[model samples]
Target: MKALVLAGGSGTRLRPITHTSAKQLVPVANKPVLFFGLEAIAECGIQDVGIIVGETAAEIMAAVGDGSAHGLRVTYIQQEQPLGLAHAVLIARDFLGDDDFVMYLGDNFIVGGIGGQVADFTASRPAAQILLTHVPNPCDFGVAELDEAGRVIALEEKPAKPKSDFALVGVYLFSAAVHEAVRAVQPSWRGELEITDAIQWLIDQGQDVRSTVIDGYWKDTGNVTDMLEVNRSVLETVEPVVLGEVDTDSELVGRVSVGEGARISGSRIVGPVMIGDGTEVTGSYVGPSTSIGDDCVIRDSEIEFSIVLPHSSILGVRRIEASLIGRRVEVTPCLRVPATHRLVLGDHSKVQISS
Candidate 1:
C-alpha cells in the first residue's frame, strides 16, 4: 500500500503566516505538523508515499527531501491548483496505480495516529474507510450520515443542513476502486471536485464504505485557534528536559522541554511549555501551553497559551495570552508619553483620547 499526503491547499485562514509559509509546515511543539503525519504513515509500514504539493511545493520538498528520515520513499506530485481532494486523487492516478492508499490531510492532527484504521483497511480491503468525530459544528466539515446498522449511507460536503454531527476527519482509506469513483463524479457547485462526492459515488454503487468515530483528540490546524490548541495538546505530553542552561536565579516547573543552547535566567517558566534551541528567556513569566521557537528572546514579559515563532522577541510586555506571534516579530511596550490609546490598525494609524 501507498500513502498520499495532501500539502497543496492554500491556507487562506492562516493569513499572513500562510502567506509566508505553508500551513502544513506550521509547528505544533517546535515540530511541523506535517512531520507528525509523515511519521505516522511510516509507523503504519507504508513506504511508498506520494505528497501532493502546490505553491509551497519547494518548501515542503526541502523540508521532506527523500522522506528517508521517516522510513518512506516520497514522490512529489505537483498540483497546479488545489481543486479539491478528488482532484488530487485524479492527478495522482499514476503514482497510486492499482493499489490501496491512505489519504491524509497535511494539516490535520489526530492524537492517536491512523494505525488502527490502516490495519483494518489492509485486513479487509474495503472500498473506502473514513475516520469521523462528533463535532458541534457539522456544517463546517464534510459530514457522514450512517444508517441504523452503523453503515455509511451518505456523505455531504459542508452542508448547510447537516445530516449528522459526525464530521469527517482528515484521514481516509481507499482501495484501487477510488480511482474509478473519482472519474465518475462531477464537480460540485463550488467548482471543485469534492472527495465527499466520490465517496458518495462509491456508496451508491453498493461498495463497502466503512466509518469509524474517533473519540480521541483530532483537529485541523488550518487556522490560528486550532493551531494554538493543537500546540497545547502536544505540549501536554512533553517531558521536562533541560538540554540548555538555566541559571540559579530562574525556576523551571512541570513538563518543560528546554532545547539545546537555550538559556533561562531570572525567569519562572511553568509546566507544559517548550523553549526552542538558542532562545533566551530572562525575567519573564512563561506560562503553560506556550511554545517559544528557536532564537527567540523573551524579557520582562508574561505569555501563556500562545505560540511565538522563531527569531521573535517580546520585551517589556506586561502580559500576552491566546496569541500567535509570527516569525521575526518584535513586541515591545508602546512607550509613547501619556499613553493615549494608540493603535495602528489596517491602513490607518490613530491615537484616540478619552476624557
Candidate 2:
C-alpha cells in the first residue's frame, strides 16, 4: 500500500507564522511536524508515497525532495486549491492508482505513530478505517456516531448537535473502494469537499466503515494553542543530551537536549526543554516545555512553556510563557509606562504594549 500525505492548507489560524511558512513545516522539538508523519509511514514499510501540496508546494518539495532521505520514494501531487480532504483524494487518483493507501494530515501529530494502525488495516482490509479520539469540543471536528455494537453508523462534519464525542483524527486508511465514494459526494456548505462526507457516502452504500478510538496522544496542530500544546507534549519525552557547549556557570536540568553549536552560559534550563543547533541562551531562565529553535538568541529573558522558532530573538523581555514566536521575529523590551484596562484586539496580527 502507498501513503498519501496531505500537506496543503491555508492555516489561517496560525496567521503571521503561516504567512511565512506552511503549517506542516512548523517545528515540534526542532523537527517539522510533517517529518513525524513521514517517519511513521516509513516505519510501516510503505515506500511509495505521494504528498498533496497547495500554494507552498515549492517549499514542501524542497524539504522532502525525492523522499529517499526518509527511505521512501515520494511523488509530489499539486492541488491548485484546497477544495477538501475528499478533493485531495480525487486529484490523487492517478498516483494512488489501485493500491490501498493511508491518508495523513501533515499538521496533525499522533503520538506512538501509526505503525500498529497500518498493520491492522493491512490485516483486516476494511473499506475505510478512521482514527477517532474523544475531544472536548466535537463541533470543531468531524464527529462519528456509533451504534449499540460500537460500530460507526453515522458521520457528521462539524455538527452543531453532535451525537457522539468522538472526533475524527487526521489519519485515515482507505482501500481502493473509496474512489467511488469520493466521486459520489458534493461540496459542503463551506464549498469544500470534506472527507467526512465521503465516509458517510460509503456508509450510505453499505460499505464496511470502521473506526478505531486512539488511546495514545493525538493533536491537530492547526492553531497556535494546539501547536504549543503539542510542542510541550513532545518535549516531555525528550532524552537529555548535550552536543553543544554548556558553560560551568550554566546548569541544565531534566530531559534537556542542547544541539551542537548551541551555547548556554550563566543560565538554568529546566527539564524537558530543547535548545536547537546554534541557539544561544545566556543569563536567562529557560523553563520546562520550551523549545528554542535553531540559531535563536535568548538573553535576559525568562521563557517557559513557549515555542521560539528558528532565528528568532528574545532580548530583555522579562517573561514569555505559552507563546508562539515565528521565525526571524524579535521580542524586545518596551521602555514606557503602562496603563492597561481592557484592549479589544482585532484578528491575526501582532500587538505590542509599552510597559
Candidate 3:
C-alpha cells in the first residue's frame, strides 16, 4: 500500500502566519507538522508516497524534496486550487494507480503514529476504513453513524443535526474501490468534492465501510490555539537533553531539550520545553511547555506555554504565555502604555482594560 498526504489547504483561520508560510510547514516542537505525518507513513514501510500541493507547493517541495529524507520515494501532485480532500485524491489517481493507500492530512497531529492502523488496513483490506474520535462539536466535522456491530452505517459532512459524536480524524484507508465513489458523487454546496461524501457514496452502494474509534489525542493544527496545544503535546514526549550552554546561575527543571549553540544564564527553565539552536535566554524565566526557536533571545522576561518562532526576541517583556510568535518578530515591553492601575494577578487571571 502507498500513502497520500494532503498538504494543500489555504489555512484562513491561521492568517498572517499562513499568509506567509504554508500551514503544513508550521512547526510543532521546532519541526514541521507535515514531517510527523510523513514519518508515521514511513513507519508503516510504505515505500512510495504522493503529496498533494496547492499554491504553497513551492515551499512544501523545498522542505520535503525527493522524500528520501523519510525513506520514501515521494511524487508531488499539483492541485490547482484548494478544493477538498476528495478533490486531492481525484487528481492523484494516476499516482495512486490501483494500489490501496492511506490519506493523511499534513497539518493534523496524532499523538501516536498510524503504524497499527496501516497494518490493520493492509491485513483486512477493507473497501474503506476511517479513523474516528469522539468530539464535543460534531457539527463542525464530518461525522459517522455506526451500527450495532460498530460498522460505519452512514456518514455526513458537517450536519446541522449530527447522528453521532464520532468526528472523522484526518487519516483514511481506502482500496481502489473509492475511485468510482469519488466520480459518482457530486460537489457539495461548498463547490468542492468532500471525501466524506465519496465515502457515503460507497456506503450507499453496499460496500464494506468501517470505522476505528480512537481514544488517543488528535488535533488539526489549523489555528493558533490548536498549534500551540499540539506543540505542548509533542513536547511532553521529548527526552531531556542539553546540547547547549547553561550557566551555573541558571537552573533547569523537568524535561528540557536545549539545542546546540543555545546559551542560558541567570534564568530558570521549566520543562517539557524545547530551546532551539543559537538561542540565548538570560535573566529570564522560560516556563513549562514552551518552544523557543533558533537564534531567538529572551532577556529580562518570562514565557510559558508559548511558541516563539526563529529569530524572534522577547526583551523586557515581563510575561508571555499561550502565544504563537512568528519568525523574525521583536517583542519588547510596551513602552506606549503607563501603569495607571497596578494590582497583583494570580496565574491564569483575566483583566479587561481598554487598549
Q: How many backbone clashes are present in model 2?
A: 1
What would the per-residue lDDT of candidate 2 be over residues 99-214, giving only the tens digit for each residue?
A: 99999999999999999899999999989999999999999999999998989999999999999899999999999999999999999999999899999999989999998999
**How would you order the candidates by TM-score, starting with the best?**
2, 1, 3
Q: Candidate 2 — which pairs collide?
A: 254-271
Q: What is the C-alpha lDDT of each candidate?
A: 0.89, 0.89, 0.88
Scored against the true structure, residue 299 in model 1 reaches a CA lDDT of 92
Clashing pairs for model 1 are none
Per-residue CA lDDT of model 1 for 1-355, tens digit only, reads: 9999999988888877777788899888899999999999998989999999999999999999999988999999999988999999999999999999999999999987889989988999989999999999999999999989999999999999998999999999999999999999998999999999999999999999999889999999998889999999999999999999999999999999999999999999998999999999999999999999999999987888888788888777766778777777777766442322221111111222221
For residue 186, model 3's alpha carbon misses the true position, in angstroms, by 0.8
Candidate 1 runs further than 4 Å off: 336-355
